[model samples]
Target: MLSLLIRGRFPSPAVADVGAGTGLLTRELAARGFAGTAIEPNDVMREEGIRRSDLNFPFRWLNGSGEATGLADQSADWLLMGNAFHWTDIENSLQEFRRVLRPDGFFTPIWVMLDTDRDATVQSVDRLLADAIPSFSRHSDVVMKFINSLSTGTSDFSNHRVFLDSHHSEVMSKERYLNMWRSRNDLQSALNPREWEAVIKKIDELLVEEKVVLKLRTYAWIFEPEEIPH
Candidate 1:
């Protein structure tokens, strides 16, 4: 999916994966032969990503955030955020991206959501979260709205087009899917200890009853930089 986004943008794309956690996206790009850098603000996460990365291709791990990447001007051909754009300061990040990207660079933000409608267990888990954490669905909706709004061009970026695409799905075991939920800091932080326990218990039960094969949906919003008069 990511390769498809950067295919024709540059002969050898110099990519920056902002907010890259554990270098998942960075490693993918490197494996595909992209000369790339992974910028992460958290020391622990960044170090872990570096430790886990075993790519033979060129890649750099940096201590940085989307708002302040500390990269050279016009140095990157493509900037990508995989499931981490929501954590960024959008205005500052957009300005920083504009500064670091070449004139023709592309910015793509991607996310993966559990396809709740496709599976009863997934819907049950969604309902459990909705009941346990009031902000779960609301926050998700807000993020979606903010991402959608970016298509109109933000104050800092006046000449860009955001092309939205989705419906790409991947299959995984129920246990792996549940672990993905457990890894979410947002959901964990929102619930009290007892509520968290109850939610997890219910999710486990549902997974067992429903036979636990998850269909995960991937969504990408590709922002193309275009010429605009000031």
Candidate 2:
């Protein structure tokens, strides 16, 4: 999506991952040769990022909020928020994003979502998740009109592009499938020990009895910055 929207065969030179949690995308950007800075306010999430990181990439982690980043003015060529933009004060954050971006910089928000049309089995699994964890239903909508309105439709934002990518990964077995469910933030917090165990047991019974893997769809939204008035 970045490649298509930016219209460049290669990646950007420098990027700042705002509200970056666990540095997942930070390291990915760094691995692509972009000098990346991860700004996260939560200490536990930041620590988890550091712990999850390879420690080889030059990822500078900063404790900052999206509304007021500690970065300098017009410093970044690109700003990225992966699955973390919803938690920000979007109005102020977009203003701050414009403040710190160069004249030709871009602000891209990437979200990896589920592909609902792949199979009936996948749909059934999704229903199970929604039933076991109601928040899953709410979290299905990652980007909303109000959230996009914060940064988009402004004179300062430009080259607005939205890309949808669908890739399929097959979870070999029921245990692997259950692990994916267990890793979800919604299920992790919503379900108690016994409840989680029951959910997992139910998943195994469903998947093994039916025989299927999971399908996923990823969506990415990229926006280039227009030159702000002096």
Candidate 3:
């Protein structure tokens, strides 16, 4: 989505992936020729990213929060926050973004939601998450609304663009699909043993009945800051 929003083939140089859990999106940027830094608060997740992801470029892993990025002012050309933005202090994060981004820099927040287009597999995954966790209800709507509000605001940004795409991928087995869900923070921490077992069993049953495939709706917006007079 940002690729379209920025009207560019790849991310800008000097990019920062704030709260880059496990470097999923960071790897994508690195692949696209951006030399980026990752600011992650979770030590375990940061280590996992360093160990697991193939980041060939020289990328610094800063121990920091989105609200208080330790990077210098006007030092970055682009800032990216993944699905983890919902967990951040948005007002503070915005200030941090303003501080770090250059005059014409871009700020992008991305959310990848499973596309529930009446596909049995998509519905199965949705049901598994909804039934397995109680806190799911409170987050999805509120966070989406917050993102929408931030995307709409014009006080800070001179130009902005929004992109929503329906994306799909295939997962061979229920276990493979389950592993993806297991990586999510809320689902991993909240689901009790009984709930987790039940969810997995249900997912297995659904896959057996109607082979599970992954479908997702990815939403992103790129914000270009108003150029500051030197």
Best by TM-score: 1
lDDT tens digits by residue: candidate 3, 54-105: 5455577888889988999999888888898779876678778888988878
Each prediction's TM-score against the native? 0.80, 0.76, 0.77
The per-model lDDT (C-alpha) reads 0.75, 0.70, 0.71
Q: Which candidate's lDDT is highest?
A: 1
Between 1 and 2, whose lDDT is larger? 1
Model 3 poorest ten-residue lDDT run:
154-163
User: What ranking of all candidate models by lDDT puts the best one first?
Assistant: 1, 3, 2
Regions more than 4 Å wrong, model 3:
1-12, 53-55, 125-139, 150-160, 164-166, 170-172, 181-195, 209-211, 227-230
Position 168, candidate 3: lDDT: 58
Error of 2 at 212 (Å): 6.7
lDDT of 1 by residue, 1-230 (tens): 55775776578888999998888888878878888789999999999998887755477889999999979999988998988887887768878888888888888888766655675766777788888877676355666666566555553333454455555455567677678778877888888888787788888777653335666666666665553212
